[model samples]
Target: MANQEKKRGIGFYLLVGVGALFVISIISRDKNTSPTTSTSAASAARPSSAPEPPKAPQIDARVTARELFEAYEKNEIAADNRFKDKLLEVSGKVDNVGKDLLDTPYVALSTGGKFDILGVQAFFDDASLPKLANLSKGQDVTVACRCDGKFGNVMLKECTLK
Candidate 1:
């Protein structure tokens, strides 16, 4: 009968559930596993003579924001010293100084009344640069950036105000 078959199916499921729970309970018992003293002693006696791994080079280890920007604006700080690859933290102003004659969004950084155009076409895109929509003229802030070093060429990326 349908009722009998339904009961049987329910019972089957209950049995399976109980079995699974029992198996899990058995597996959950902690095993007092530990390295043997002999093994540890052997390791200590031999010891790893290999040199320790080199520490990760911190970003500041190379250059800071001011240094990176100055290098680009100067361009005489060695050609092999490409800085467009590092993330630099900078302190400046947040602004959208209007587009150029060709209609590109322009951003300026004000530092002690000496403002420099971010120098590259990049610091304008909505994705890379900060929205700066809430900012007023001359509001000071810090930003993280990567520099593209070309003569009189400096752009900021990941521009964020802190």
Candidate 2:
């Protein structure tokens, strides 16, 4: 009968639809589980704007923070030749411990004068936050950092407590 034929046709299409779905799911599963595909997908999911962690350079010099500041104040060009872009270990009393305008943590070390406004400014990375949190004014400390020359103050970057 035509009615029986129509039912069989509908049932056949239903079965075919299910088979097509099963095939698609298997193909998708294989693609998702592939090593290359998964690795690339994971990398793609990471934010492009995320910055890499800062790396500390090898120490190239060691001096007191006051000595470092005086060197730059006396002659910037000579100081730059001696210390610019080089890692230095500077020791001094903490003038202040606070964040810069950009919210970067910094420790201002005294340059041997009570009312001196200029000194060595050591900027630390996020990883040094815990150590910096324990620091206080007038506390003697030593920092290892890259000498970035002077900009109002003798600047030290990528600093870590020593």
Candidate 3:
């Protein structure tokens, strides 16, 4: 009789454990299915309207070629992270206004030495080639550019004379 009671108790515990697991699995399955169905219904209702295009990021700061060089000299990684991908309006003496290795037009802003080696390099859009062609060494120019961060020198892309 005692043995039969012990066996019945073990069977009851096993059944309870299985029942708890089944309930938990069903609850979890329902939770997982609900979100997917709601998302599908929401998309089906909004199929015609397209999402808006993202706006261009605003300019973070402006500085001259000398100031920009000084910032990088002080802390290269910090300056790169702070100014990378930000729009800028930089004004300085023209160092070089010519073609790059890829034949793309560029305007180098002087940080006070050699034209090509020690300066901020600003690459122009194809439309600005004619305007860039007119720029000469030693002339002052202010250009709006998207900063590409410092390599050997500070680099700017999509530059336009301002």
Candidate 4:
């Protein structure tokens, strides 16, 4: 009967639709998880030859941690104009040394108050973990880094002992 034929056609189309969706999902999953795909993408983005050694960033200024923190606390805009993104040699008495919420190592340098909550925060790379482990609170230290402006604390990034 024509009615039976129509039902069969609808069922067939539904089954085909489901099969097509399943195939598409598998293909998309493969594209997402394929190691070769990621490897090829990484290769395309990298240089073909040997990479050169990284050069040290030039020092733009030198100041104590208190001086740096006070500068930002006084006038954020003026301080940023003078030190933001510029490499600096900052020396201060260490207040703390620990990893941040994201596991980034940092050293907090005192900015002068006996019960101060904020200080200059200097972030170091993972390679500096051993060096950071050797630091103690109240010890004098100097670091070279780029000033990343203030966010509660004056942030210094890519820091290394100087």
Instruction: Give me the candidate number with maximum lDDT.
Output: 4
lDDT of 3 at 74: 90
Q: Worst 10-residue stretch by lDDT in candidate 4?
A: 30-39
- Per-model C-alpha lDDT, please? 0.55, 0.91, 0.86, 0.95
Model 2, position 50: C-alpha lDDT score: 61
* Each model's Cα RMSD: 9.8, 12.5, 14.1, 8.4
Q: What C-alpha lDDT does candidate 4 achieve relative to the native structure?
A: 0.95
**Clash pairs for candidate 1:** none
In order of TM-score, best first, we have 4, 2, 3, 1
Candidate 1 C-alpha error for residue 130, in Å: 8.3
In Å, residue 81's CA in model 4 sits off its true spot by 0.2
**Which stretches of model 4 miss by more than 4 angstroms?**
1-55
Give the per-residue lDDT of model 2 (tens digit) for 11-108: 99999999999999999999888779677898899867868789756689899988898899889999999999998999999989999999999999
TM-score of each: 0.41, 0.66, 0.61, 0.66
Model 3: per-residue Cα lDDT over 48-108, one tens digit each: 7777899865667889988888788799889888787889889999987888889888988
RMSD (Cα, Å) of model 2: 12.5
**CA error at residue 125 for candidate 4, angstroms:** 1.0
